[model samples]
Target: MFRLLIDADSFPLGKGPMVMLILFLISTIFIFARSEEQGQKLEFWIFANTHFEEYQTRVPIFEAENPGVNVQLINFGGTMHDKLLAAMLSNFGAPDLVEVEITSIGRFLKGAIDEVGFVDLRPRLESEGWMEKLVVSRFTPWSYRGRIYGIPHDLHPVVLLYRDDLFKAAGVEMTEVETWDDFIAAGKKATRDLDGDGTVDQHAIVLDRRTESDYFSLLLQQGGGFFDEEGNVIIDSELAIETLEFFVSLFNEHKIATPVYGTWHGDPSNFAAMQDGKILSILAPDWYVGILKSQVPQMAGKWKAISMPAWKPGDRRTTTRGGTMIGITTQCKNPDRAWELLKFTYFDRGGLVNRYETTRIIPPLKSAWDAPIFKEPDLYLGGQPLGELFIELAPDLPPRYQNPYWSEGADLLNDAIFAAVTEKQTSREALTELAAKVRALIAKDQGRWRDL
Candidate 1:
């Protein structure tokens, strides 16, 4: 403390001051070198308009545990897709990690971009037996050319969310509904005009006419999707045509269901229908639970979630719908650390528990289901253990072929559905027409598309 500064003019030896200065510089460099080695840095970017805020709460735990790692979270929200596309096109500015929506993921999986854009996670994933741990079909949507590119954020297993009160009023017991035929009969019984108006006020179920969402849900459940295992279009197959016909019958022949033209589940009229007991049930995925809770809060305790009714008495009881996949981009500067962050967010049991507890987005990891939170009864579903039901249905999910042309293909299918239901075209007629249109579209870009 006497004198911290060294005076070169007053130094005893000629080289003493120079040696001391060098020593000080070396010490400073050593400290900085050690500091940098200890603090590994990672940069992450997510979609701007998405609800992944829980990551903000949970990432601190990851950083704290890693000690020398710093993960910088950048949220692009609304323009994330455009930015990500630009970054990929230029081969710059892409994030180490990204959250890609299921519908939009097909775009990223096509052509040269897929080869250079996203890392193949299979090597690391297989080492840990990651596929065996989660439902195997959960990998289907994120897979392209037999390579797994992303980890599933949630299973989004489809469930039939129904009004138990309405089921009771219709004299239909949940256990009694074993097959789709039984479901249709119950719907017929449930639908009636309470006020004796010419128009029936109540319907057994609701579907979207402008969208193939409900049709897609059921079609996937029936093991018929837009593409087959070999990447060939199979949407016009016998099973696919049959599934479409069944959906059409619900409205025209059975008269037990009604169609909404736009965003059916999110529509105000649909919410009012749910509130007024006009629509007793909806064919939706697990994420739709939060939508119901927020959009139709008064519906609490009156609803229940059950595995979707099977097409046959003992077929697979459920299928997957909407979900997101978190992937590691090939442009990652620190892929090892990036994988660590991704594994923690998606595959780690504790992280999954925290994710479900905070955001209520169910995890794809099966071990996470053992947590007490998953076991607790949801009061929103009349104390039914909906989590347990979702877990039970996870294993049986059919593999979905999400091809590059899926976006355009889905539109064609929706148009086909519209024709089948509204225009009263036979399922075969609608699908045959759809197949021709899809075939032509695919022929234009033969490499990116598969033949029907």
Candidate 2:
């Protein structure tokens, strides 16, 4: 045992005895560490390989504030979708907190899984006033029939990334290309045989044939979707047919766009196309900036972003694409503690600022827009303030919904897009077949939503 002794050399020197002070500090630190070690451990499963470093940096701050709680940030690499589905189906091994991407969350939002799978957060949202703090549109993707299951982590507003050097060389001005027709004309002019190879060596745009960004981004920008407000299948609508025709015409008719080999990441063809200067522009979201920086650093400072060219003069210029949301599962034992961690990680002012500053992720919280981090100029985009552009485009985005059959629908649509663009079938014919197949699926899966 340690004995407490009082030193009288200078009546404790007005600072207490040195040994006692040192022991007190040590005991306080020990108690704090022990409390944190014995805290309620909440498991958080995340699938973002790119943003993991930034997340690791913020986890400790949350743990420090909530001394009785510890969060385990587990990264499941690229197979999170399959793993999550398996867990939800088997009703076991589900994490307390799970980050679901926009492309895959539709499965969790519909069907039997959605009925008893996750916690409905609307009550907590109303009590905490989080609805006003966050962008309402960001939550739309994670919302099911009359329920919100998750909180969005960021707003992924789409933008047109163009090479200024290529644009200047092609004699195309962004301001002059306001509509899709103008963009098509510019594309035709931009495609050229720069090296005198007797073949058009450079095209105006490159698109991912697999992911069908043209269908999702452009269709949404034109206020069209695969489904309507009442969850009806409408992929064969006039707007969708026209959008499909226009997207295909860029490659088949104008010969201004190149079809890349794969979707989004690890596609050597896309990487080579960008490096060889084979395209003038690519329509992508703000998150693609990070991909460009990490995957093709050589092209830094040569690219700039602009609002998406409108379908018509007064049409919406931009629409959102990809994002991730954190949902609390019904498997969560300590929901109150999990909510505390979620609030600190996402809604906390300091965490939001740090995330934006470090990762360039546009937070969904409206209050975060006022931070000085949003005003910082990006060096990769020729000193363009990309945040301001996203902020401007985020609010006007048209509402979008994903049905339970979106995964199947996306697959069928990708096939339809491939068929139409490859000249195997007409756009209308392919989409009509697609709509038929999707309607059959919706009917077979559940008899009620087959009215399309």
Q: List the residue pairs that clash in candidate 2.
A: none
lDDT of 2: 0.81
Cα lDDT tens digits for candidate 2, 283-367: 8776777777778888879888888989889788898778888888887878888888778778878887787666667888888
| Residue 342 in model 2: lDDT | 79
Residue lDDT tens for model 1, 1-452: 58537666666775676777779999999987864552277767777333457678778999999987888788887677778878888997788889887887877766753554889999989997787888778888988887888888888888888888878887888657878898989998888888887889888899887787888888999888988876788888999999888899999999988886246678887788788787888887777787777788788899987789998878999988788888888888778899989987778788777766654567888878888888789888989987788878887888887787888888778788998998668899999888878877777777554432
The lDDT per prediction is 0.81, 0.81
> After superposition, which runs of candidate 1 have C-alpha atoms over 4 Å from their true positions?
1-39, 48-51, 113-116, 447-452
Backbone atom clashes (below 3 Å) for every candidate = 4, 0
**Sliding window of 10 residues with minimal summed lDDT for model 1:** 34-43
